[model samples]
Target: MTRSPTQTGRRAFLAGGAALLATPALAQTTNYTTPFENSTVVERDPSEVVRRNISSFRSLDWRPYFSDTRNGAVLVDTTSRALHFWSGDQSVYKLYPTSVPLTEELTRLGRTEIVRKVVGPEWRPTPSMKERNPEWPDYVGPGPDNPLGTHALYLSWTYYRIHGTHDTRKIGRKSSNGCIGLYNEHIAELFGLTNVGTQVLLI
Candidate 1:
């Protein structure tokens, strides 16, 4: 299929194999401890400045269990910090930890689907993010240091994503604005294994 210029550009950018896990120098210095404190002290690794903000990813109970859905489904258990990909078989699945919280507004429980998939996706800071950091760049080109990592599965929801992150340490916590964050390697694998329109269930 002939992709539009934007898609073509994205594909080309992704084809370059961007890193996706490096923090922008500006982001590295902003302190997340007091998000709205108006402090410009420039703390190191601000996004990952604190691990206690949410549950640790390592503490989650991850194991194979039965799901009646026999076709396929992407199961996200925020409470357990795990994302399970069920392969239409009750017995087969690949489990990865949930790296971000299900923000109340972004939660679309029940059923949804993957609307789109892109490799080396660009990073566009949300409005709230801009409010927090006015100095943030309007757009981050696709590359290794891009916040979206190496791949992204855009959900049916207006502003939700299952994508990779620059900071792996933020995994299994309430970090992202509302999207599901995954390690760069894990997302690359998931991106290869799934297709558009795959079922996604957040609970």
Candidate 2:
């Protein structure tokens, strides 16, 4: 099925990514105004930040990134702070703004696949996370305050996941510790689309 471009300037923005930022049509429609920067310091509270990252949200063909969309494919572009998904049959495609790792040291790249799916997922800070923030709670059950929001898709890599975040401001920013984060509604849609063994790649 052909996808309808309901939002004005979205087609142009997706077609060219950063290159289209200069166009007046897209500039007027887009809300990204923050300058992009690499920082070593973690954003403890992203909501307090006045500016957000100007992510290069773009649509991508899956062929170049994945050999095949076997059980479907998910590609997370750390530099662009965007995630791309394609169905196995090549009938569906989706692009979403994402929150990536805070720093280069925290980022992981390469191939991985979804091994599990969970609804109302619990949260546990990793050992390293705990070491860094000792005051953080050891565990958190699912709720509005939970870091991992409504749904989570577990990846083959340990302590890594493509999950939803309650914090909407984090999207389109370098706000995640390690995992790729999506808006709750977006993750809910993705959760229904993806299944176990769905191929994933982070770049």
Candidate 3:
């Protein structure tokens, strides 16, 4: 199958990044910590920032949101940079730039229902990751301060995940330790709707 210029571009970028990751120079990985972690990634007045970030991604209200009627599924139109949630055959929610550049595969960011949802999650630091950041906390229960957030939809192939963040500002920007983060509020909603076996594609 023929790939588009955009696909080729993204692929080249990822390949280059992977090469960098494999480099002996960058092979020295470091444990990532946020202001939230020292403070447990939590603070007062989360709603104000959460509410604002929600609007920043797309100028629509997320609460009474709409999704598609497409088999309780999601179609992340990477080309359009939009995230469409379908309930059946109709859309109940459509969020845009609610998006980021897809770096891994499948040309997108968000996970599906199967691989996207987990409860009472643990933060098992990977061998490589731990080697880099020996200070990273061991696996802990799901909560506001937990690195996994209240709920997590782990990516199938690796330790990477599409999880929640206390740092709401990270949403529109491409800032993360390789995971895709949503505000705590949005993730809470996802927790209620998604399941453990949900499939998450990153094209």
Instruction: Looking at model 1, report the run of 10 residues with the lowest lDDT sum.
Output: 23-32
- Clash numbers, per candidate: 7, 0, 33
What's the C-alpha lDDT at position 23 in model 2? 27
Q: Please give the lDDT score for candidate 2.
A: 0.76
- Root-mean-square deviation per candidate: 16.8, 11.3, 16.6
lDDT of each: 0.63, 0.76, 0.47
lDDT of each residue in 55-167, candidate 3, tens digit only: 22332322243243233544443333334343343334434233233244323354444554566566676675557567776665666556656667665657666666555
Weakest 10 consecutive residues of candidate 3 by summed lDDT = 23-32
Instruction: Give residue 44's lDDT in candidate 2 (0 to 100).
Output: 58
Instruction: Name the regions of candidate 2 deviating beyond 4 angstroms.
Output: 1-55
Which of the numbered candidates is closest to the native, going by highest lDDT?
Answer: 2
TM-score-based ranking: 2, 1, 3
Q: Residues 1-203, candidate 2: write the lDDT tens digits.
A: 66676654677656565442332112111222220121113455543433333445566778899888889999999987778888888778877778888889999999999999999998888999879877778888888878888999999999999998876666766787798988888899889989999999999
Candidate 1 accuracy as lDDT: 0.63
Runs in model 3 with CA error above 4 Å? 1-71, 75-83, 96-113, 195-199
Clashes of 2: 0
lDDT of 1 by residue, 1-203 (tens): 88899999988766543323222110111112311122122223544333232232232222333345444577787766667775554344566765655366644556688899999797777797689678877888787667777889999887778998766655655666677878788788778767787788787
